[model samples]
Target chain A: MSNKKIGCGCLGCSIPLLTFIILLVIILPLSIFGVMNGAFGSKGIPAPKVELPAEVIFHIGVFPVTNTIITSWITVALLILMALLVTRKPKLIPGRLQSAVEAIIEWMYNFCKDVAGEVKGRKFFPVVTTIFLFVLINALLNLVPGYGTWPITNYAGHEVILLRGANTDINTAAALAVIAFIFIEFWGFKFNGLGYLKKFFTVERAFKGWGKVFHGKLSGFGDVLFGAIDTIVGLLELLLEFVRLLSFTFRLFGNMTGGEILILILFFLLGFAGFGFVQVGYIFEMLVGVVQALIFAGLTLVFATMASEHHGEEEH
Target chain B: MNIFDKLAELGFSWPTLVAQIVNFIVLLVMLYFFAYKPVMKMLDQRAQKIKDSLDETQKIKDQAAVAEQDFKKRLEVASKEGQEVIARAMRSGEEARQRAQQEAKVEAQAVVEKARQEIQHERDEAIGELRQEFADLTIVAAEKVITKSLNKNDHQKLIEQVLAESTTLNKKA
Candidate 1:
């Protein structure tokens, strides 16, 4: 077959092919050298340090601002800017940006509605969507290049990176966990009123059992036993609610830090070989980021729904 | 170990947490006003517009159907009226033709009756003249046969009486 029949046989095809060949030729030796250097420990490149704490970039009054806070601000600015840009003049017949913005919001709205009933979903939508977007954008933006590269000398005369992943910082995670906790409890109280406290306090069952026991009914001992168990269970439930804050904070912080470290280690190990392979870690991190964001947001939604439910009403 | 010290070891600062919380609240508020509310409103508005337009289209379709029915009804009425007019015109034409025929027949019969009367009158006058000529001729023949002069008035009376008797005899036969 003629070249024209076989392929495009044009400069466009040849140019990319030549570029690929050249890149392969260059990359092959470089990869081998990188592998050799990594194996032999030639001290050519130092291993990257894994820092758990976010470096304080500056201070406002007594409050020491960290790099993660800066990143969070950047995330907030980016999100707000995008929101404003897309929704400046919303049209019935939307443009591309408007359509994308609407699709995301609508998807989140429908998700909330699906999980919670319509009335409760409307109440939960803002906080749930905010948490999802905040976590998601913060995680995704952390993967962008130059986040950990820009070093600046602080007022304390210590060198620290200017920006870090917001989720990597314990303080930010803790803040989000605190917010989620507060909102969950708030919604619980709002929906179920003072009866919400009954979820954690089972004095009524025990009180009834005590009253029966005082009336000289021997079978009331069974009720008393069960009531004590119920009270303990309620106490445990209360403890679990507090424990959720710690879990929520650490889950995000651990995953984000581990992802960052994992990518760093991969880059250090493979050196030039990391060119193609490190992308795998990045892809993994991206998936982890999306999953973690979803988990954080989804858990908060589930917890809030559980909290708002009238537990005592179901038994009656 | 102090719990605060332990928390500090893990890089959890109260000020930073508070700042972050404040930041998040700011973000949430901003996003609510800028993104969620407008987008949700726009979506609802679009849905409403679609529903309204669909309803309008259905209404217009229904109106078109009603108009078509009305037009068909009117067309049927007009056609029925046209047929009735045609039938009425035909009836009037038939009556006019019958009336003209009856008048023509009467006129033709009148003309025939007048012609028959005129023919009878002419025949009677001609018979009277023929009878008068015959009388004159008989008189002249009697004068020739006698070959002498006689009273004219007496001969005339005798001839008239003879003629009257012969006419009566003809009538009897």
Candidate 2:
């Protein structure tokens, strides 16, 4: 009831998290029930799907914006209003909301410090922190219900759901990953010239042609053999870059798709998962999605940091 | 081109795609306005506060260190002053002891001098009595021979001896 967050521990992180949890309680059941009511694919066990009584039957208007869209807008508006009300004017000595915000800031600062050194930390903050926030808010937004219903009607007079989990959409995840990869590569190229590619290729120091190479005995045979080895290593480096890109794209896609499918399957395919109020795995699904996004962001930083780092020492 | 036209005939319109893009863009913008700005501001402020707190903690530690050093300095000074006080007390004690010893020596000399004076007075008194007795004896002898009365003279001389002995005893007491 008080402005203060209920629990003493991690009250900062926990309060916003609790709000999301409450939202889940409302939207999760409603959407699942909606889906079970033949809005989505179905299994056998049939409850008389408690159809959300026509909340002014999805938009009859020509435009996409309607009741469902309005709700989405409200959700967005609520998020904005809360932020403004909590933050806006900074206090020298903070109240509860300020303290909660500060906790997140400290967490992020430490995260940046640990992953990227201070200089890279500052540079990466804009992108990395932005990604973190984007994924998080989107995840929360996906928890919102009445999306398909409130705006546009399906053929059976149901609300047409327009918006969904942005990351859950393959297009969104793939796009984000690709953009992040491109940015990382850009930073790499900016820092290290064309021959930075050589660092990955050419397993020069590791095999070392039996250490006589260190003795500077560049015999003709040694040169030829090492050159072949270098060429192969260079090919491997090129292969590895492709692999990095694929994995980056694949990882984000897999996690988000899995989370979305899991939730959908839970409601329509496996009703037992959402039976009663024991639909907790949905939250876990949300958590998994968040972790996936974080992993993606973290990988970007790692690649960026490594690419920008001094290359010569990496060989040794 | 005929197949594309047929698909278009099936009602896929560029306007819809544009509208969807517009919808997406609007959503993104709305999200940015709603969530991103506040979150970022919150984050920035929080970060600054944490840094400030850490700096404050460092300042407190510095002050504590200074205070500790000052306390140690004061203790050292107090210890030095304590030693000086002890040394002064010991020196004064020694001087008082010497003064008391000197006073005792003077008192002993005075006692000795008074005893010596008493002994000299007693010796003088005894010598004066002895000299007077000798003169009286000579005078008694001359009277006995001149008058030719031996018994009366003997009696007078005996009485005189008794009187001299009594006065000498009184002086000794």
lDDT of 1 by residue, A1-316 (tens): 1334546546335777767867888788878887876733436434788777788888888788899999999999999999999988778899998998899889888988899889899889889999999999999998898787677998789998888989989998899999999999999999989888888897677778889889998788888888899899989999999999999999999999889888888878887566778898999999999999889988999999999988865355
Model 1 residue A170 lDDT score? 91
What does candidate 1's lDDT look like per residue over B64-160, in tens digits?
Answer: 9999999999999999999999999999999999999999999999999999999989977877776677667666866674576558886687768
Residue A240, candidate 1: C-alpha displacement in angstroms: 0.7
**Deviating ranges (above 4 Å) for candidate 2:** A1-87, A90-121, A144-265, A268-280, A295-316, B1-104, B107-115, B122-173
Each model: TM-score of chain B?
0.68, 0.62
| Tens digit per residue, CA lDDT, model 2, B76-156 | 999999999999999999999999999999999999999999999998888778667866875786676657756877778
Query: Cα lDDT for residue A194, model 2?
Result: 69
Least accurate 10 contiguous residues by lDDT in model 1 chain B: B141-150
Q: Which candidate is the best by lDDT?
A: 1
Each candidate's DockQ: 0.63, 0.05
Q: Which ranges of candidate 1 are over 4 A from the true structure?
A: A1-30, A38-46, A313-316, B90-173
Q: Give lDDT: candidate 1, residue A2.
A: 31
Q: After superposition, how far is residue B125 of candidate 2 from its true place, in Å?
A: 4.2
